[model samples]
Target: MPRNRATASPLFVPRKATRTQQRVARAEFAKARTKARAAQAPSRRREHEGADPELQPSYPASGRPGPASARGGRLRLPKHRMTTAVAGGAYPFLAEAGLGAEGIFIGRDLHAEGSFCYDPFALYNSGRIEGFTNPNAILCGVIGMGKSALAKSIATRAIAHGYKIYVPSDPKGEWTGLAEALGGQTIALGPGLPGKLNPLDAPGRPTGVSEEDWTNEVRKRRLLLLASLAATVLKRDLLPMEHTGLDVALDLVVADAEATETVPLLGDIAHVLGNPERLDAALGDQAGGLGRAADDLAHAFRRLVHGDLSGMFDAPSTVAFDPAAPMLSIDLSRLGSSGDDTALVLAMTCASAWMEAALADPAGGRRWVIYDEAWRIMRHVGLLERMQQQFKLSRGLGIANLVILHRLSDLLSAGDAGSRGRVLAEGLLADCSTRIIYRQEPDQVQVSMSLLGLTGVEAQAIGALTRGRGLWKVAGLSFIVQHLLHPREKPLYDTDFRMTA
Candidate 1:
């Protein structure tokens, strides 16, 4: 049917329809198209500028800004609803901006599809991310999720940035190869092994400290080690009198070792603790009858000296500490493989103490202390307490601790809720400003969400993450990254050679 002439703005407009209606519709179309282009890539946005009269089309571009479609009906976009995450693919430019291209290049940001980089020290120093107050970080993932590879990548890449790596205790001994490859040192400690570590050894005084101050500092550290060992063995905290006894025993050992001009050994301290009379007399007029107080403490240290765990930490250290070493790790894979980890925990205590003493120097340059298999240590309050100190002092020491675990629930297993072990475990989690979570089993998603304070969506994302990918939460910001491996690093970081072969 032929119709009367229509107004430009509307198909059924009266003859009296004004030109303002047509101008208004065109104005709205231009405004909406401008907004759509604004969300596009910068390069795409620039395409709208400066048209060439020769090559430019005389008609408008596709999805033309007019009242109707070229098919003779009003233009309409077929409405479809989808999750923003799924829609992001069709709108790639609307993803996260990403944590800038600085520090160690980890891999690629899954959402942004851009390079991903991370450096705790760099991020802490930049002051870009608020709530990122500490340099410490924790990583959790189920087995085969590549958490170890990510950790190794951080350690290997960090070397180029003038940072030192220290694996205070390597349970699996896997880091031995990586440490050696980086031209670092690894001390394997076990029964009948030649390597020995004396936790009482004093680190060289820092440049500015006075001699007297260094002496006192060494004494304090030694006392703390003794108390921690006793606590772990006895399964309880030391009393004031027991603390006094340890203090007395350590002073006697230090005095004798310094007089002999020899390094102090754990056996020396254990020996003094065994003789309460000696500890009592050492205190002189200050105290007496302290022998009874130290009787139990003696048994605690005796395990490290003359018991099954002897020969590892009882003798003088075979190798001296190299302050400039790129990395240092103690291998305890062969030891404490039994069901009971008491012996392993004790060894970790002594080894960590030695490393902590060396790392006490603030000017040792930036360092990373990776506590691999940290879940094993979380059960003992004494270990957690000692580990807590490292985390608390990490910022001042210019050290970052990367604590790895199999799942977030590992923290819950530290102790019953409101218990000391639980408190320490939660405290450790609090101190870590960065948390990297790899793929998890379905049952683990709830634990990850509760412990890490992740939203339902984030929790869901974690359960579905594939290998070599993780959800990184820096400060309060979050990112999903696919951990890319280098060709050369594949051989070094691979832990699946046995199954693959």
Candidate 2:
């Protein structure tokens, strides 16, 4: 301590702060700060109250991660385990509640991994599904995707539920076996086939309709059938006078047949049309061009009478419709292959008219009108208009129509966009409350998505669906369903037997 430099003055040297002194100072500082905050609280509160919501600073609960973020960072949940029943309640998004147990058990729901069941009538009556307005359904898929099997299965199973099944036009004759197996009737018509169907045969009157009303309704139906036939044969729409000629001829034929106690025939109408004097005389003062206008109509009806389609639909029906039969399909496979669908179309028109007339009876009970291979008929506008009328009246007629198509785009083939045929096709689609989609071609996915309003996830799911698996959209809801076929049903529904053989 060599020269202990003059000892630093105690006054100039700083002394260490005492613990007691530090505590006292801190207490005073805290008191001053608390007082200042208390004075500012009222002003801050007023500012917040007066501020506009849009101008207020925001802290969203979810968004890009940042200091203001609701902490969307990597969230590590604790490894807490619970029973599935309990977990279902904790995490509702994982497991779903399914459609209840009612109606026919169709298949398995891929989402809930539970059994899937569907019955248009049941769904319609339950009022469970919102926006479900009708009992009609549309089944669309590429061939060999089990769409036909699904349809046949539905028809087979529905019979057990006390429902009737009607296949209006079976061009391929595939349903004949099922019809015969189920004790249903199958009428096969072709040249030299002896099976004849008079499209004009009147169905039994429904319970509530009066005799006069029923008679008028039959007349209207007959006129519509004739018009559709003539249009199909002539390859064009009938002119106004041609229509009047048909109208007059139908009245005359119906009157003579009713008087003679015999059913009307196509030949009778054609004969009445070929004679201009008869049509002209029938029109009275308006007969100036009725007979001439009917000349084309006479030739058109001639094709169904004395032409290549002779003896088919031109005479009295040989088979009476048995409505009580569990299933009824008109087997038209015997129709000659004339290198065109014309003969098939004409036959289908006649068969459909006959069956539809019987179905119009309100007391016919709940039934299914399945138009298998309906794509062929979609190309014809007259046929589409007729089918559209049936679609609109399905609910009131106490029936459901299951329109089977190879693909949704088949409807587009009916005509170009916005054509009359296209409008009718779209109308048919709109009338259906349920749409079942089997696996579609890659090109058809976008079309299906647009037509059915499918989401990105649904669109992806449908593209990968296996055979027998379909996406059933009931009302606005969706389900990935795998249609299960019973072992016994496999043989009956086996369309591959020809190849397997």
Candidate 3:
């Protein structure tokens, strides 16, 4: 074996082999370390900025760009080069940018409110708010602050922008004028009004009933609805027994099956609850004599609903709109004075008709209903929440509601403090996505600012707004525009013709 040693090859002879083995070992170690570091790190996409990765970097789908093939002569980016805004910054210069004129703008502006009458187009297009983001909006201001005027102006602009509108007529008069101006129809409804027209009831064959009957019916239904709401409120706040005066009145009306029975109910309440002292005590000093009035109202409703005049509670009469018209106005002044029961009836009728029309024309363009002085009748009816809920379900149907109130606390009338009335209002406001808050007292300003999540400067802005000025915000948009006054229309109101813009 010793003699054959030279013939046997050496165990390790090549220098190149040794170097290659060391290099392979080092590379394997480095690869293992890299994988371990990756596993230890958090499994989330790096977030250097607060941007939503899934949202398209443009307006609505209507504004989306066409595919490369459809671009014709334009040079296109490679398939892999179509990076999203999520990648960190703006798209490349060569990228197809979309800045279409399809969206509504919302942000801070410096225009005065009354100016809308003169330059409605500019005021509407000033980019103070983006309607597409939040279709809902709140118009909050104190009494005589011209909240109604501003609401009307904004609605007009919305109409110009191809939107439909629904407004709860305060006292039934507002709708008539606005409808005429906007080329819309005015339908009245309440206790007796039939919101629909019937070929069966046309003049001759119709049993000698006049149009007054239709008007009277609307009045009765409105009274009943208000009575029901007020009764519910009193039962919760003032009734001493489980069987309230309202309950007794209802029982009598239902049992008697006669309109005259309601008078006795009214007489009973007027005789007993009409004692000013007792009513004042029951409603608290702030409430005044609302209790007695409520009692009277309850009896009146029962009588109207069950009497020979029962046609007064036959539902609502609808005024159809002509989509081709420029405007239409519903005159509630003809119905009656503002605070009277007649006004209440007319307003409720208009609201009922508007709601019915909106629901029926679901495929119509965007429609909005603006309610000015909403607190007037809202206290006696549950229509606020009902309309709000309906509007929520009506998104696809192009229906929306705009409610203008002097204060946020007025929502308490819908229920109680323990109830979610305020919360519901807040949710409704938030859903609306647009807000126009004008100058208000410090207390109201603070409340508005808090709800909208504004800072000190923004809060002060709302409080400092003047008659034609307001703070406007459009949800999902970055800017908050300051709105200015719109131009005054020639003879905004006329007694002879009703609403003459």
| lDDT to native, each model | 0.86, 0.85, 0.48
lDDT tens per residue, model 1, 277-314 = 78777788775568588889888988888888889888
TM-score of each: 0.81, 0.81, 0.49
Q: Mind giving the per-residue lDDT tens digits that candidate 3 earns over 1-501?
A: 343222232332234446655555556656766787578445322332356756534433334333533544667687765343432134322221212234333222332211112122232346443454435566777765667666666666667777666654545355566666666766553344454321111111123445687435433443344343444333333343323444344333333434553222232333333343544554455533445444544444344344322333233333444544443333333333434453354345434544443344445555665666666545543455555555576555555667777765555455565564545555566676656676778877666666677767677777766664566554532122344333443234222343434
Q: Residue 465 in candidate 3 has what lDDT?
A: 67
Q: In candidate 3, what residue range of length 10 has the lowest lDDT sum?
A: 197-206
List residue ranges in candidate 1 displaced over 4 A: 1-94, 285-288
As a whole number from 0 to 100, the lDDT of residue 409 in candidate 1 is 87
Q: What C-alpha lDDT does candidate 3 achieve relative to the native structure?
A: 0.48
Candidate 3 ranges beyond 4 A from true positions: 1-108, 111-133, 187-303, 306-350, 377-381, 412-415, 476-501
Q: What is the lDDT of residue 175 in candidate 1?
A: 94
Under the 3 Å rule for N, CA and C atoms, how many clashes does model 2 have?
0
- Candidate 2, residue 409: CA error in Å? 0.6
Q: Which segments of candidate 2 are over 4 A away from where they belong?
A: 1-96
Candidate 1 minimal-lDDT segment of 10 residues: 1-10
Best by lDDT: 1
TM-score, candidate 3, is 0.49
What overall lDDT, based on C-alpha atoms, would model 1 receive against the true structure?
A: 0.86
Candidate 2 lDDT score relative to the true structure: 0.85
